[model samples]
Each structure stands twice: as C-alpha cells, then as structure tokens.
Target: MKRFITGQHVSLWRLTKRVTAQNPMMKYLIKKIPPYPTPVEFWVSNVAHVTDETGFKGILKSEQFRAPKSELSWWDLKIKKEEIRAAEKNYMKRNFSNKAKEPNEQKPFLETFTTSPLFQLKKSRYGNYRFTFPLAELMEWYKEQNCGGKEPVLRVYGTVTYKQQIVYTVLIHSPEDSERFGEYPLLEASEWVRYQDGKIIWKAQAICETHRYQFVSGEVQRLKTHLFYVWDQVSLVFHLPNRTKPCKAVKIPRQRLIEALEACKLDRKIDLLRYKSPKNKEERFFEAKMKVSELKRELEEEVKEEKSEAENDIKMEVDP
Candidate 1:
C-alpha cells in the first residue's frame, strides 16, 4: 500500500520512479528521456496501462502545485471544473431523471473524497474489486455519529482477514477512548486515521494481496500514501471468501446503516469474532475467548522480541 501515497497527493515523478525501478524495462524506457518525464506522455504510455489499484490510475496525479502560481499546471483548473460539472449533472439527474441513472463507465474523480465503509465490494471484469456507496447516506451517518449529544466518537481499524482478505474493519474503540470503550486491544490503526464522511481512512502498510508486504520500502510520508477507497479497482484481497452462495445485494435503508454503525461500537462489541446468535451463544463466545487468548500469546512473543538486548531486523518477503 505504501507504493501509493498515504495522502491524496504525491509527486508524480517519484511514484512512477518506484514502479519503474521495480520493472527495469520501464525504468530504462523512462530514463531515455532527460531531466524529467513528460507527465502526460508518461501517464498515457505506462501509468494509463497499469490497471491495478496501487498505481495512480484514477487519481488526480496530473495537476501539481508548486512555488509560483505559474508553476501549477492548467490540468488542475480544467479537471476541477469538469468535476464540479459532473457533480452538478449527477444532482440534476437524481432529481429529474425518471429512471435510476446508469453507473458511470468512467471511475470517480476522487481528489476531494476519502474512505467510506458504506460501499459494497463487487468483483470487476479483471477479477479485481470495485465498490460504490451512497454519498447522502454516508454524510447522514457522519453527522449522527459525530454531532449528536455526548456520543462517543467511533473508532475504525483496518486489518487483513485470516484468509488475506484486505478489508478495513471497524474494530470497537481507540486506546485513548478506553474510559468509554473499556480496555481492549490498542484499537489503533497501523498508521493514523482520518475521519471523513463517516469513514475512518487509514494510511496502513499491511501484507495485502496486491502490493505484497510494505514493511519499510521507503521513508517518505507524502510518498507513502497507500490509501483505501481512493481508487476504482482495489486488488488488495487475493481471495474474497465465499461464506455463502453469492446473492444480489439489497439496498439497505440509511437508518439501518446508522443503527449498524452504533451496534459495531465498543458498547455493542459486535464483529470481534465474538458475535453470538440465539442458538450458538455459548459456543461462539468460548471460541472467541480462545481466539483472543491465542492472539494475546502472539502479542506477548512479539513484545519479547522487541525487548531483546539487540537484534537485527528480519524482513520477510511474503507477497501475494
């Protein structure tokens, strides 16, 4: 994920350099050009062809801001106006169109947007993942969660599922919020979290399916922006598990979504692998307890390794 920038923006030159560095042929081709690459040409030839999530495929990587106003490219101004027009058209369509508008063939221009959990993960033609969530519902949830009286701010965490399903899970609470949440796991994301539009956007570097293990490839924050939900096709999960036969997703009510959000908090304590039903309450509870114990042991061992007198870092190259 670090291959992508942690924040919305990063240097186009450096981003391209990383991929090209890995693929020597691309690097050599790029190096053939002097001083720096022609942004549009490089994007069209190589970046455009990269149909993966890690690459800056749907990103606003074209326009860059620099010292002088003259240094900034016209791309940003033109694209911004186009984006505003797209939004205006969408709003008009929603209000006036008789039928539900068809999904845009072009991916979203997400220069100003952030992560949202209300989306549905769907398989793409290229065996990748693309998702869509309602903007209106998300905004409502955000207000309900953050603006209401004495409501504890919801905390979100990202983790890879046991099957290596790369997903951002809303695990109960943050450590600082223990007074309200009770003592649990750190409840912290791998990196910082940015709460936006009711979703907690995490800048995490995990062992995802696509980008492999990004432990410490580089040491730049601006360049290390592997954000979730910022692009169209996300290839993070190698195997999206089949818990049951797939069914058409029903459009859930926004009110249900708000209720669902509340139920996932530390107060309700759901989806911690500890969720119980009417029939298997005791069995599931015990299973969750055992799993927690096992994870505690793993954590202990990790702490021990960290406390050792002096040890060299052992890097593992476990890629998908």
Candidate 2:
C-alpha cells in the first residue's frame, strides 16, 4: 500500500508518537491526535466504490465510529482516494459561505445537491415554498408515515437551513419493524445521549417539525418516493438523528450511513425526544412566566402540606 504522508506507514507514526515525554519528573502518556481530519465525505460519485471496498464495509465506515488507526494510512488504505476534490470543495464552500455575507449580499448559495424525494414538495406549483424542499419538516413527516407511532431515526442525511435554522434530509429507519430494519442501528440510550465527562460533553435534541409534505408526497411521489440517489451519499451533510451542525453541505460517508441504519433498527428504549426552542420573544416570555407560576404554585402546596403535618403533630402531642 502507498504511504499517505510519506514512505512511513501509519503504524510507525503511531509508534513514534506513543509517548510525548520520557523524563522521570515529567513523564506523560500523551495519546497522539490524528494528524488529518476524517475526510469530510467521500466524493459524491465515489460512494459505490466506498461500499464495495471490503475494508470500508459495515459500521467501520462512519467517521463517528472509526476505530483508532494510523492517520497517515487511512486515506490510502481504507478510503482509497486522498479525497482531494471533496476536501478542496468543502474548504472553498466553508471559506465563502452565505453566512459570512451581509444580508443584501447573500444572493444564493445552493443547488440541487441531493436526489431526495423532499424536492417534490418544492416541485409542486403552489403548495409550498417555490424553489426548495427545505428538508426539516419533510423528514419528520416521513418518519410519521413510515413508522406509524414508533420513533424513526435518520441513519444518514444531507443538510440545509430553513428560515436560518438548520434542517436535515435523511434516510430514516425504525427499531420496531426489525424485519424491515434489522440491518440498521438500534442506537442504545447511553450511546444516543452522551454526558460531559471531565473531557467533553455531548447533547442531542431533535424537535419534530410538523408539515404537510406527506400530503404533498401522496400526489407527486405516489408510491415511489425517492430514498435519495445512492450515488451521492456524501451529499448527506447533516444526519437527522444528529445534533452537531455542519457549516457546509457535504456528502455523508456511505459506511457511516450503513452502521447508523443497522444500529437504529431497535428502539433500545432510548428517548430520542427532540425538544423545540421557542421561536419568538413573545413565546419565550410566555414560557418563562408559565414556568415561574408553576414553580410558585408547587412551592405553596409544599408549604401547606408541611404546616398541616406540624399542626397534626402538635395536636397529637398535646392530647396524648
């Protein structure tokens, strides 16, 4: 295999970096950070190639679940291409994204990045926003239609912002219907919700955004709604079951998608409830006022119960 960085293999690199310091007074077992970031995504057309790679199969594919490896050799060995174009494109897009531009200067910065069925909503003449599907609500609706009352997890997806907030267009699967979804992930409660150890914290919230996309789907897609074109797997920028937001549009790794799909096949008794933040100042004020009132009412009830118990105790002591 060709060395990614030099004639030096990744294992050699790891061996060299195993200990940062060797002095008796200042010895430290420092783990080496990966020299290269995981490829933002495989190239759009390279997804099938990725899936076909035996070493790149199953759960090992997703960047999130990657096992520790020699950073130098990951690209040359597991992923094949140095992923130069994908990296360069991501760099360019990130450097000059619309978010950096002034309001009037923000002209346009999107194209039909993914072959998702949500676009059909945008395709309709007068039912919704004219140019785009905006993916946020469409996914939630897809879960509703396909999984019935059971929770649906987005195994892989792309992302876009709807009205300034980020949204995801994704491949969804449910845990309850294992026959149909047994191959996918059934993310465990502990894995789904992570905590802040001394090192870092992880939090995820997925609020349901209700929409009429299902009604619209009945017309345009009929029964053959797209599951998204498999070729552009890297185009999945943000996964639906993910809380971490991406700044630029990129395809998700196909290997990552498969692991998530396989793992989310079971509910795992995880409460992946998505909470919605208040949209406006008025709603925030009302929510705050209600919370305060509820707290005060509970305090009063507790005080009254305590006083009643004291009085009963005094009566018993005096009578006895």
User: In TM-score terms, which candidate is top?
Assistant: 1
Q: How close is candidate 2 to the true structure, as a TM-score?
A: 0.20
Deviation from native of the Cα of residue 60 in model 2, angstroms: 42
How well is each residue in 1-320 modelled by candidate 1, as lDDT tens digits? 22222212222233344444444323322431211101110000000011112211122132111112121111100112343335434533544355324546433322122122211111111112112233234324323432342333333322322222233333322123446433222324323333344333333222111221121221111323332211121111111112324411123343232222110111121232232244343443344345434545665676687866334333323332
The lDDT for every candidate, in the order shown, is 0.26, 0.27
What range of 10 consecutive residues in model 2 has the weakest lDDT sum? Answer: 70-79
Residues 1-320 of candidate 2 have per-residue lDDT tens digits of 11112111112223235322442211211322211111122222111111111222322334322222311111101112233333334533554454344434433222112122222211211111111122333334434544564555533222222221222222334444455544433322222211121111111111111111221211211223222111101122122222224311123343333322211111122212232343433343344345434545665677799999999999999995
| Clash pairs (backbone) in predicted model 1 | 4-225, 5-225, 5-226, 6-224, 6-225
Error of 2 at 169 (Å): 10
RMSD per candidate (Å) reads 25.2, 24.7
- C-alpha displacement of 196 in model 1, angstroms? 3.1
